[model samples]
Target: MKHGFKQRLFIVAGILLVVCAAVWLVISAISDNMRYFVSPSEIQAGIAPEGHTLRVGGLVVAGSVRRIAKGLTVRFEVTDNASTIPVVYTGILPDLFREGQGVVATGKLRADGIFVAGEVLAKHDENYMPREVQEALNKAEGAVDVGNAMRKSAGGSL
Candidate 1:
């Protein structure tokens, strides 16, 4: 009876070890696939990791969209009013993509400071903007307000 109990315990331990390893592998795979959202200002300040997939949200800079080939390859600039990042995408852009519209691009930042986008998403409705883009804009506006206040206190132009 003692030998039988020891064998059963060893079997259970082996099963538990396999289960734990499987769970760990699944969690690591999911985390590796996850992408983070960032603003153009954050990217410019070196807050976003290079070579890691990330999403960037901002308004499409006016007069910046240009097609480089007969295919769907295009390039443009996304800006948060304070900072701008150039993006290149090879896929067909959304129907709503246009100048001055809000956009989100998911991809990796290259060494040359340009975002190589895997997907480009544009605002679908005229009055709607991505939540990330809205938050970034608000932050930029607040910063501008603070700067103006500081200038006024220093006896500078409003």
Candidate 2:
């Protein structure tokens, strides 16, 4: 009876260990591969990991978009008022994508600060403002308020 009980205990412990390992594997796979969206200034501020993938959204800078080799490769710039980020994509862009319009790109940041896009998404309408652009504007407004406070403290006039 003692030997049988010991064998059963070992079996239960082994099953629990395998279950734990499987759960860990699933969680790691889900979290490590997921990507988040950011903006041009956020990239400039170093908010993302250099080697990891992410999405960025902003307006395509006017006259900064160009097509090459029969549309096999395209280059463009995404910008908020604070800054702009150059992007390169090798795939066909969405029809709605154009200069002075909102766009979202999925990719990783290269060492030189350009967004190496794997996918390009364009805004669907004129009334659309990309989420990245909205966030950047909020941040900029906050900075302006802080600057105003400092200037007021110094007795400066606008």
Candidate 3:
């Protein structure tokens, strides 16, 4: 009976070890592949990691879109009202892509500070906007509102 109990305990221990290792591996893999969703303001603030995959959302700055002389490459700027980020993309843009509209781009930021997008997504309709872009705009507007309120309370101009 003692020998049988010892064998069962070892077997259970081995199984537990395998489970733990598997969990660890899954966590590691997820962390490695995770991409951050951020705003152009955050990128301008120097918090977003450069050369790492990131999803940035904001409005396409008016008149910022330009096609390259050669190739399908296009360059534009996305803004969160407070800051703007230049983006470079090499593929076809979405049909809804245009200035003064919401956009979300996924890619890495080069050391030169331009976002090199692997994919660019645009808002589908006039009334619809990407959640991230809306959030970023809301956050910016909130900040501006607070600033105005503070100035008023402090007897300063808006």
Candidate 4:
């Protein structure tokens, strides 16, 4: 009976090891595919990963959108109002994409501080903005308010 118990223990340990290995593999795979969402201010603060793909959400700066190379490759600046990041996308933008609209671009940041976007997603409706973009804008506005309050307390002009 002791020998049988030892055999059962070994089997249980082996099963547990396999389960752990499988879980580890799944977690690693998911982590590798995960793309973090960040704002223009965060990008300006150097919070974005240099080479890893991530999502940036903010308003497309008015008059900053430009078409290059026959209008296929486009460049624009995305802003959280407090900060802006230049973005280059080499494909046709969404139909709703326009200046002063909310946009989320997925890509990696180039060494020259430009965001090379693989995909550009724009807000669908006039009243609808992406949640990430809205959150980023709100955070930037809050920062501006705090800055203004500090300046006022220090007797500085607005």
Give the whole-model CA lDDT for all candidates, comma-separated.
0.82, 0.76, 0.81, 0.83
lDDT for each residue of candidate 1 in 44-152, tens digit (9 for 90 to 100): 9999998899999877776789999698899999877789899999988999887776789999999899999999998787567677777887686443332332234
Model 1 Cα RMSD, 1 decimal: 7.6
TM-scores of all candidate predictions against the true structure = 0.82, 0.77, 0.75, 0.75
Per TM-score, the best of the predicted structures is: 1
Worst 10-residue lDDT window for candidate 4 reads 145-154
Q: Report how far residue 148 has shifted in candidate 4, in Å.
A: 20
Any runs in candidate 4 off by more than 4 Å, and if so which? Answer: 1-17, 141-158
Displacement of residue 48 (Cα, Å) in model 2 is 2.7
Work out candidate 2's RMSD over C-alphas: 8.7
Q: Tell me the tens digit of each residue's lDDT in model 4 across 1-158.
A: 99999999999999999999999999999998899999999998899889898999877776788999686899999888789899999988999887776789999999889999999998786567677777777789554333333234334532
Off by over 4 Å in 3: 1-10, 141-158
Q: What is the lDDT of residue 76 in candidate 4?
A: 94
Better structure of 1 and 3 per TM-score = 1
Span of 10 residues, lowest total lDDT, candidate 3: 145-154
